[model samples]
Target: MDSMMMGAMSKNMESMPDMGMMDMSVMQACMDACAACEQACTVCSTQMMDCSPACMNCADMCNTMMRSMMRMQGMTPASMMAMLNACIAMCQVCMDECMRHADDSDVCRMCAQACQACMDACMAMKDMMMASA
Candidate 1:
Protein backbone atom coordinates (compact mmCIF):
# COMPACT_ATOMS: atom_id res chain seq x y z
CA MET A 1 0.00 0.00 0.00
CA ASP A 2 0.97 3.62 -0.51
CA SER A 3 2.06 5.82 2.38
CA MET A 4 -1.19 7.72 2.28
CA MET A 5 -3.22 4.53 2.54
CA MET A 6 -1.05 3.27 5.37
CA GLY A 7 -1.43 6.56 7.18
CA ALA A 8 -5.20 6.35 6.79
CA MET A 9 -5.21 2.79 8.00
CA SER A 10 -3.08 3.75 10.96
CA LYS A 11 -5.44 6.57 11.77
CA ASN A 12 -8.38 4.19 11.75
CA MET A 13 -6.56 1.65 13.89
CA GLU A 14 -5.66 4.33 16.44
CA SER A 15 -9.17 4.02 17.81
CA MET A 16 -8.13 0.76 19.44
CA PRO A 17 -6.32 1.58 22.66
CA ASP A 18 -3.99 -1.38 22.37
CA MET A 19 -3.03 -0.43 18.83
CA GLY A 20 -1.95 3.04 19.77
CA MET A 21 1.72 2.12 19.72
CA MET A 22 1.65 0.05 16.56
CA ASP A 23 4.52 0.67 14.16
CA MET A 24 3.00 1.40 10.79
CA SER A 25 6.14 0.41 8.90
CA VAL A 26 6.22 -3.00 10.56
CA MET A 27 2.52 -3.46 9.95
CA GLN A 28 2.93 -2.59 6.27
CA ALA A 29 5.82 -5.01 5.91
CA CYS A 30 3.80 -7.76 7.55
CA MET A 31 0.86 -7.14 5.23
CA ASP A 32 3.14 -7.10 2.19
CA ALA A 33 4.77 -10.33 3.24
CA CYS A 34 1.41 -11.97 3.79
CA ALA A 35 0.27 -10.97 0.33
CA ALA A 36 3.44 -12.29 -1.26
CA CYS A 37 3.18 -15.54 0.66
CA GLU A 38 -0.44 -15.97 -0.33
CA GLN A 39 0.39 -15.51 -4.00
CA ALA A 40 3.38 -17.81 -3.85
CA CYS A 41 1.41 -20.51 -2.06
CA THR A 42 -1.44 -20.27 -4.51
CA VAL A 43 0.96 -20.74 -7.40
CA CYS A 44 2.77 -23.55 -5.68
CA SER A 45 -0.47 -25.36 -5.00
CA THR A 46 -0.99 -25.78 -8.70
CA GLN A 47 2.21 -27.84 -8.99
CA MET A 48 0.19 -30.85 -7.78
CA MET A 49 2.97 -32.07 -5.53
CA ASP A 50 2.92 -33.52 -2.01
CA CYS A 51 2.97 -29.97 -0.66
CA SER A 52 -0.15 -28.91 -2.55
CA PRO A 53 -2.51 -29.26 0.37
CA ALA A 54 -0.26 -27.34 2.70
CA CYS A 55 0.25 -24.66 0.10
CA MET A 56 -3.47 -24.20 -0.40
CA ASN A 57 -4.10 -24.01 3.33
CA CYS A 58 -1.28 -21.56 3.84
CA ALA A 59 -2.58 -19.38 1.06
CA ASP A 60 -5.94 -19.17 2.72
CA MET A 61 -4.43 -18.45 6.10
CA CYS A 62 -2.21 -15.71 4.73
CA ASN A 63 -5.11 -14.12 2.89
CA THR A 64 -7.19 -14.15 6.06
CA MET A 65 -4.36 -12.71 8.14
CA MET A 66 -3.78 -9.92 5.65
CA ARG A 67 -7.46 -9.07 5.49
CA SER A 68 -7.75 -9.03 9.25
CA MET A 69 -4.86 -6.64 9.55
CA MET A 70 -6.38 -4.38 6.96
CA ARG A 71 -9.66 -4.30 8.83
CA MET A 72 -8.46 -3.64 12.34
CA GLN A 73 -11.39 -1.77 13.78
CA GLY A 74 -12.58 -4.50 16.17
CA MET A 75 -9.28 -6.28 16.76
CA THR A 76 -7.85 -6.44 20.25
CA PRO A 77 -4.20 -7.05 21.03
CA ALA A 78 -5.01 -10.60 22.14
CA SER A 79 -6.88 -11.35 18.94
CA MET A 80 -4.12 -9.82 16.81
CA MET A 81 -1.53 -11.89 18.61
CA ALA A 82 -3.56 -15.02 18.05
CA MET A 83 -3.93 -14.29 14.37
CA LEU A 84 -0.22 -13.70 14.00
CA ASN A 85 0.50 -16.95 15.82
CA ALA A 86 -1.83 -18.83 13.53
CA CYS A 87 -0.26 -17.27 10.44
CA ILE A 88 3.21 -18.10 11.66
CA ALA A 89 2.23 -21.69 12.35
CA MET A 90 0.65 -22.09 8.94
CA CYS A 91 3.68 -20.57 7.22
CA GLN A 92 6.01 -22.92 9.07
CA VAL A 93 4.07 -25.94 7.90
CA CYS A 94 3.91 -24.74 4.35
CA MET A 95 7.57 -23.82 4.31
CA ASP A 96 8.59 -27.22 5.59
CA GLU A 97 6.42 -28.97 3.08
CA CYS A 98 7.66 -26.83 0.22
CA MET A 99 11.29 -27.22 1.22
CA ARG A 100 10.92 -30.96 0.83
CA HIS A 101 10.62 -30.47 -2.93
CA ALA A 102 12.73 -27.39 -3.24
CA ASP A 103 15.62 -29.37 -4.71
CA ASP A 104 13.59 -30.32 -7.74
CA SER A 105 11.04 -27.55 -8.01
CA ASP A 106 11.75 -23.88 -8.45
CA VAL A 107 8.19 -22.96 -7.53
CA CYS A 108 8.44 -24.82 -4.26
CA ARG A 109 11.70 -23.07 -3.49
CA MET A 110 10.16 -19.69 -4.18
CA CYS A 111 7.12 -20.57 -2.10
CA ALA A 112 9.31 -21.67 0.77
CA GLN A 113 11.18 -18.39 0.60
CA ALA A 114 7.95 -16.45 0.63
CA CYS A 115 6.69 -18.45 3.61
CA GLN A 116 9.92 -17.77 5.46
CA ALA A 117 9.63 -14.06 4.75
CA CYS A 118 6.03 -14.00 5.96
CA MET A 119 6.97 -15.80 9.16
CA ASP A 120 9.77 -13.37 9.81
CA ALA A 121 7.54 -10.37 9.21
CA CYS A 122 4.84 -11.77 11.47
CA MET A 123 7.40 -12.43 14.20
CA ALA A 124 8.64 -8.88 13.95
CA MET A 125 5.09 -7.62 14.31
CA LYS A 126 4.58 -9.81 17.36
CA ASP A 127 7.80 -8.65 18.96
CA MET A 128 6.95 -5.02 18.29
CA MET A 129 3.52 -5.48 19.84
CA MET A 130 4.97 -7.15 22.92
CA ALA A 131 7.54 -4.43 23.39
CA SER A 132 4.92 -1.72 23.10
CA ALA A 133 2.55 -3.54 25.42
Candidate 2:
Protein backbone atom coordinates (compact mmCIF):
# COMPACT_ATOMS: atom_id res chain seq x y z
CA MET A 1 0.00 0.00 0.00
CA ASP A 2 2.74 2.42 0.97
CA SER A 3 4.88 1.69 -2.05
CA MET A 4 1.89 2.10 -4.36
CA MET A 5 0.96 5.38 -2.71
CA MET A 6 4.53 6.63 -2.89
CA GLY A 7 4.78 5.72 -6.55
CA ALA A 8 1.63 7.69 -7.31
CA MET A 9 2.83 10.59 -5.22
CA SER A 10 6.16 10.55 -7.03
CA LYS A 11 4.36 10.80 -10.34
CA ASN A 12 2.46 13.83 -9.12
CA MET A 13 5.61 15.57 -7.95
CA GLU A 14 6.34 16.91 -11.40
CA SER A 15 3.67 19.57 -10.88
CA MET A 16 4.89 20.53 -7.42
CA PRO A 17 7.88 22.83 -7.81
CA ASP A 18 9.59 22.45 -4.45
CA MET A 19 8.50 18.86 -4.13
CA GLY A 20 10.90 17.91 -6.87
CA MET A 21 13.70 18.68 -4.47
CA MET A 22 12.22 16.51 -1.74
CA ASP A 23 13.42 12.98 -1.09
CA MET A 24 10.68 10.52 -1.92
CA SER A 25 12.43 7.80 0.05
CA VAL A 26 12.34 9.93 3.18
CA MET A 27 8.65 10.59 2.66
CA GLN A 28 8.02 6.88 2.16
CA ALA A 29 9.92 6.07 5.35
CA CYS A 30 7.87 8.58 7.31
CA MET A 31 4.60 7.20 6.01
CA ASP A 32 5.70 3.66 6.81
CA ALA A 33 6.73 4.72 10.31
CA CYS A 34 3.38 6.41 10.87
CA ALA A 35 1.53 3.26 9.82
CA ALA A 36 3.64 1.05 12.07
CA CYS A 37 3.22 3.43 15.00
CA GLU A 38 -0.55 3.50 14.53
CA GLN A 39 -0.70 -0.28 14.60
CA ALA A 40 1.54 -0.50 17.63
CA CYS A 41 -0.47 2.09 19.50
CA THR A 42 -3.72 0.33 18.68
CA VAL A 43 -2.35 -2.91 20.07
CA CYS A 44 -0.89 -1.18 23.11
CA SER A 45 -4.18 0.56 23.81
CA THR A 46 -5.84 -2.81 24.27
CA GLN A 47 -3.58 -3.58 27.22
CA MET A 48 -5.76 -1.45 29.52
CA MET A 49 -2.69 0.17 31.00
CA ASP A 50 -2.27 3.78 32.15
CA CYS A 51 -0.92 4.64 28.70
CA SER A 52 -4.11 3.56 26.94
CA PRO A 53 -5.44 7.06 26.36
CA ALA A 54 -2.16 8.33 25.01
CA CYS A 55 -1.84 5.28 22.81
CA MET A 56 -5.28 5.84 21.33
CA ASN A 57 -4.63 9.51 20.67
CA CYS A 58 -1.26 8.79 19.12
CA ALA A 59 -2.80 6.18 16.87
CA ASP A 60 -5.37 8.65 15.56
CA MET A 61 -2.75 11.35 15.04
CA CYS A 62 -0.44 8.96 13.21
CA ASN A 63 -3.25 7.84 10.92
CA THR A 64 -4.14 11.44 10.15
CA MET A 65 -0.52 12.29 9.48
CA MET A 66 -0.12 9.33 7.16
CA ARG A 67 -3.27 10.24 5.25
CA SER A 68 -2.18 13.86 4.96
CA MET A 69 1.09 12.77 3.44
CA MET A 70 -0.78 10.65 0.93
CA ARG A 71 -2.98 13.62 -0.05
CA MET A 72 -0.17 16.00 -0.82
CA GLN A 73 -2.31 17.92 -3.31
CA GLY A 74 -4.15 19.36 -0.31
CA MET A 75 -0.98 20.25 1.56
CA THR A 76 1.40 23.18 1.51
CA PRO A 77 4.94 23.05 2.88
CA ALA A 78 3.76 25.02 5.92
CA SER A 79 0.86 22.66 6.55
CA MET A 80 3.10 19.66 6.10
CA MET A 81 5.57 21.03 8.60
CA ALA A 82 2.80 21.71 11.08
CA MET A 83 1.40 18.21 10.71
CA LEU A 84 4.84 16.68 11.15
CA ASN A 85 5.40 18.68 14.31
CA ALA A 86 2.05 17.63 15.71
CA CYS A 87 2.71 13.99 14.89
CA ILE A 88 6.16 14.14 16.51
CA ALA A 89 4.72 15.72 19.65
CA MET A 90 1.98 13.11 19.92
CA CYS A 91 4.50 10.33 19.44
CA GLN A 92 6.70 11.77 22.16
CA VAL A 93 3.89 11.82 24.65
CA CYS A 94 2.85 8.32 23.78
CA MET A 95 6.42 7.04 23.93
CA ASP A 96 6.96 8.57 27.34
CA GLU A 97 3.72 7.12 28.65
CA CYS A 98 4.51 3.68 27.30
CA MET A 99 8.06 3.77 28.60
CA ARG A 100 6.76 4.23 32.12
CA HIS A 101 5.61 0.61 32.09
CA ALA A 102 8.20 -0.86 29.73
CA ASP A 103 10.02 -2.69 32.48
CA ASP A 104 6.97 -4.81 33.15
CA SER A 105 5.15 -4.98 29.84
CA ASP A 106 6.55 -6.18 26.51
CA VAL A 107 3.66 -4.49 24.71
CA CYS A 108 4.55 -1.18 26.29
CA ARG A 109 8.17 -1.61 25.31
CA MET A 110 7.27 -2.34 21.72
CA CYS A 111 4.86 0.56 21.62
CA ALA A 112 7.50 2.88 22.98
CA GLN A 113 9.95 1.70 20.33
CA ALA A 114 7.41 2.31 17.61
CA CYS A 115 6.69 5.79 18.94
CA GLN A 116 10.40 6.58 18.98
CA ALA A 117 10.79 5.38 15.38
CA CYS A 118 7.79 7.48 14.31
CA MET A 119 9.21 10.54 16.02
CA ASP A 120 12.57 10.00 14.36
CA ALA A 121 11.00 9.57 10.95
CA CYS A 122 8.92 12.73 11.42
CA MET A 123 12.02 14.69 12.42
CA ALA A 124 13.84 13.40 9.36
CA MET A 125 11.00 14.62 7.17
CA LYS A 126 11.09 17.99 8.89
CA ASP A 127 14.83 18.25 8.43
CA MET A 128 14.57 17.36 4.78
CA MET A 129 11.92 20.01 4.26
CA MET A 130 14.00 22.60 6.06
CA ALA A 131 17.04 21.73 4.00
CA SER A 132 15.09 21.97 0.78
CA ALA A 133 13.64 25.28 1.87
Candidate 3:
Protein backbone atom coordinates (compact mmCIF):
# COMPACT_ATOMS: atom_id res chain seq x y z
CA MET A 1 0.00 0.00 0.00
CA ASP A 2 1.06 3.58 -0.65
CA SER A 3 1.99 5.90 2.20
CA MET A 4 -1.19 7.88 1.61
CA MET A 5 -3.36 4.80 1.88
CA MET A 6 -1.52 3.58 4.96
CA GLY A 7 -2.10 6.99 6.55
CA ALA A 8 -5.77 6.88 5.64
CA MET A 9 -6.20 3.41 7.10
CA SER A 10 -4.46 4.41 10.29
CA LYS A 11 -6.70 7.44 10.64
CA ASN A 12 -9.81 5.42 9.97
CA MET A 13 -8.91 2.59 12.34
CA GLU A 14 -8.77 4.86 15.36
CA SER A 15 -12.52 5.17 15.87
CA MET A 16 -13.66 1.83 14.54
CA PRO A 17 -15.49 0.03 17.34
CA ASP A 18 -15.50 -3.31 15.57
CA MET A 19 -11.88 -2.91 14.58
CA GLY A 20 -10.83 -4.48 17.85
CA MET A 21 -12.44 -7.74 16.75
CA MET A 22 -10.66 -7.76 13.41
CA ASP A 23 -7.12 -8.81 12.66
CA MET A 24 -5.46 -5.83 11.01
CA SER A 25 -3.09 -7.94 8.95
CA VAL A 26 -5.91 -10.08 7.61
CA MET A 27 -8.03 -7.04 6.90
CA GLN A 28 -5.18 -5.40 5.02
CA ALA A 29 -4.66 -8.47 2.88
CA CYS A 30 -8.38 -8.81 2.11
CA MET A 31 -8.70 -5.13 1.28
CA ASP A 32 -5.74 -5.30 -1.08
CA ALA A 33 -7.02 -8.43 -2.74
CA CYS A 34 -10.48 -6.93 -3.18
CA ALA A 35 -9.05 -3.81 -4.74
CA ALA A 36 -6.93 -5.85 -7.13
CA CYS A 37 -9.85 -8.10 -8.01
CA GLU A 38 -12.02 -5.09 -8.77
CA GLN A 39 -9.46 -3.63 -11.13
CA ALA A 40 -8.86 -6.96 -12.85
CA CYS A 41 -12.57 -7.63 -13.22
CA THR A 42 -13.17 -4.15 -14.61
CA VAL A 43 -10.45 -4.52 -17.23
CA CYS A 44 -11.57 -8.02 -18.17
CA SER A 45 -15.24 -7.01 -18.44
CA THR A 46 -14.41 -4.36 -21.00
CA GLN A 47 -13.19 -7.08 -23.35
CA MET A 48 -16.84 -7.91 -24.19
CA MET A 49 -16.77 -11.43 -22.80
CA ASP A 50 -19.99 -13.42 -22.34
CA CYS A 51 -19.57 -12.91 -18.58
CA SER A 52 -19.36 -9.14 -18.84
CA PRO A 53 -22.42 -8.45 -16.71
CA ALA A 54 -21.26 -10.63 -13.81
CA CYS A 55 -17.76 -9.24 -14.02
CA MET A 56 -19.14 -5.69 -13.90
CA ASN A 57 -21.23 -6.49 -10.86
CA CYS A 58 -18.31 -8.16 -9.10
CA ALA A 59 -16.05 -5.23 -9.88
CA ASP A 60 -18.43 -2.81 -8.24
CA MET A 61 -18.93 -5.04 -5.20
CA CYS A 62 -15.21 -5.59 -4.71
CA ASN A 63 -14.54 -1.85 -4.91
CA THR A 64 -17.24 -1.19 -2.35
CA MET A 65 -15.85 -3.88 -0.06
CA MET A 66 -12.38 -2.38 -0.33
CA ARG A 67 -13.63 1.09 0.52
CA SER A 68 -15.68 -0.17 3.43
CA MET A 69 -12.63 -1.81 4.94
CA MET A 70 -10.65 1.39 4.59
CA ARG A 71 -13.41 3.29 6.44
CA MET A 72 -13.97 0.88 9.27
CA GLN A 73 -15.55 3.43 11.57
CA GLY A 74 -18.82 3.20 9.66
CA MET A 75 -19.23 -0.52 10.24
CA THR A 76 -20.61 -2.71 12.99
CA PRO A 77 -20.10 -6.43 13.41
CA ALA A 78 -23.42 -7.05 11.71
CA SER A 79 -22.57 -4.67 8.90
CA MET A 80 -19.16 -6.23 8.49
CA MET A 81 -20.64 -9.69 8.31
CA ALA A 82 -23.18 -8.57 5.76
CA MET A 83 -20.47 -6.99 3.65
CA LEU A 84 -18.39 -10.15 3.85
CA ASN A 85 -21.31 -12.29 2.77
CA ALA A 86 -22.07 -9.94 -0.11
CA CYS A 87 -18.44 -9.94 -1.19
CA ILE A 88 -18.32 -13.72 -1.13
CA ALA A 89 -21.46 -13.95 -3.21
CA MET A 90 -20.10 -11.45 -5.70
CA CYS A 91 -16.81 -13.26 -5.89
CA GLN A 92 -18.52 -16.56 -6.46
CA VAL A 93 -20.48 -15.13 -9.36
CA CYS A 94 -17.40 -13.47 -10.79
CA MET A 95 -15.23 -16.56 -10.50
CA ASP A 96 -17.86 -18.73 -12.09
CA GLU A 97 -18.39 -16.24 -14.88
CA CYS A 98 -14.71 -15.69 -15.53
CA MET A 99 -13.91 -19.41 -15.47
CA ARG A 100 -16.30 -19.86 -18.39
CA HIS A 101 -13.96 -17.82 -20.57
CA ALA A 102 -10.65 -18.79 -18.95
CA ASP A 103 -9.70 -21.19 -21.73
CA ASP A 104 -10.10 -18.51 -24.38
CA SER A 105 -8.85 -15.41 -22.57
CA ASP A 106 -5.82 -14.91 -20.39
CA VAL A 107 -7.37 -11.83 -18.82
CA CYS A 108 -10.44 -13.80 -17.81
CA ARG A 109 -8.26 -16.49 -16.25
CA MET A 110 -6.31 -13.95 -14.25
CA CYS A 111 -9.51 -12.23 -13.22
CA ALA A 112 -10.88 -15.53 -11.92
CA GLN A 113 -7.69 -16.16 -9.99
CA ALA A 114 -7.94 -12.71 -8.43
CA CYS A 115 -11.56 -13.28 -7.49
CA GLN A 116 -10.66 -16.58 -5.86
CA ALA A 117 -7.87 -14.97 -3.88
CA CYS A 118 -10.13 -12.15 -2.77
CA MET A 119 -12.79 -14.63 -1.71
CA ASP A 120 -10.32 -16.68 0.27
CA ALA A 121 -8.95 -13.61 1.99
CA CYS A 122 -12.42 -12.38 2.87
CA MET A 123 -13.37 -15.77 4.27
CA ALA A 124 -10.22 -15.81 6.34
CA MET A 125 -11.16 -12.38 7.65
CA LYS A 126 -14.60 -13.59 8.62
CA ASP A 127 -13.06 -16.55 10.41
CA MET A 128 -10.69 -14.31 12.28
CA MET A 129 -13.53 -12.06 13.36
CA MET A 130 -15.54 -15.03 14.53
CA ALA A 131 -12.62 -16.41 16.49
CA SER A 132 -12.12 -13.05 18.14
CA ALA A 133 -15.77 -12.76 18.96
Number of the predicted model whose lDDT against the real structure is largest:
1
Q: What TM-score would every model get versus the actual structure?
A: 0.97, 0.95, 0.90
C-alpha positional error of residue 68 in candidate 3 after TM-score superposition, expressed in Å: 0.5
Report the number of the highest-TM-score candidate: 1
Q: Is candidate 1 or candidate 2 better by TM-score?
A: 1
**Cα lDDT for residue 40, candidate 2:** 99
Model 1 residue 76 CA deviation (Å) reads 0.7
Worst 10 residues of 3 by lDDT: 14-23
lDDT of 2 by residue, 35-133 (tens): 999999999999999999999999999999999988888889999999999999999999999999999999999999999999999999999999998
Any idea what lDDT model 1 has? 0.95
When 2 and 3 are scored with lDDT, the better candidate is: 2
Q: For model 2, give the 10-residue run with minimal summed lDDT.
A: 13-22
Ranking according to TM-score, highest score first: 1, 2, 3
lDDT of each: 0.95, 0.93, 0.88
Candidate 1 lDDT over residue span 1-133, tens digit each: 6789998898887777867599989999999999999999999999999999999999999999999999888688899999999999999999999999999999999999999999999999999999999
Off by over 4 Å in 2: 1-5, 18-20
Q: Which parts of model 1 have CA positions greater than 4 angstroms off?
A: none
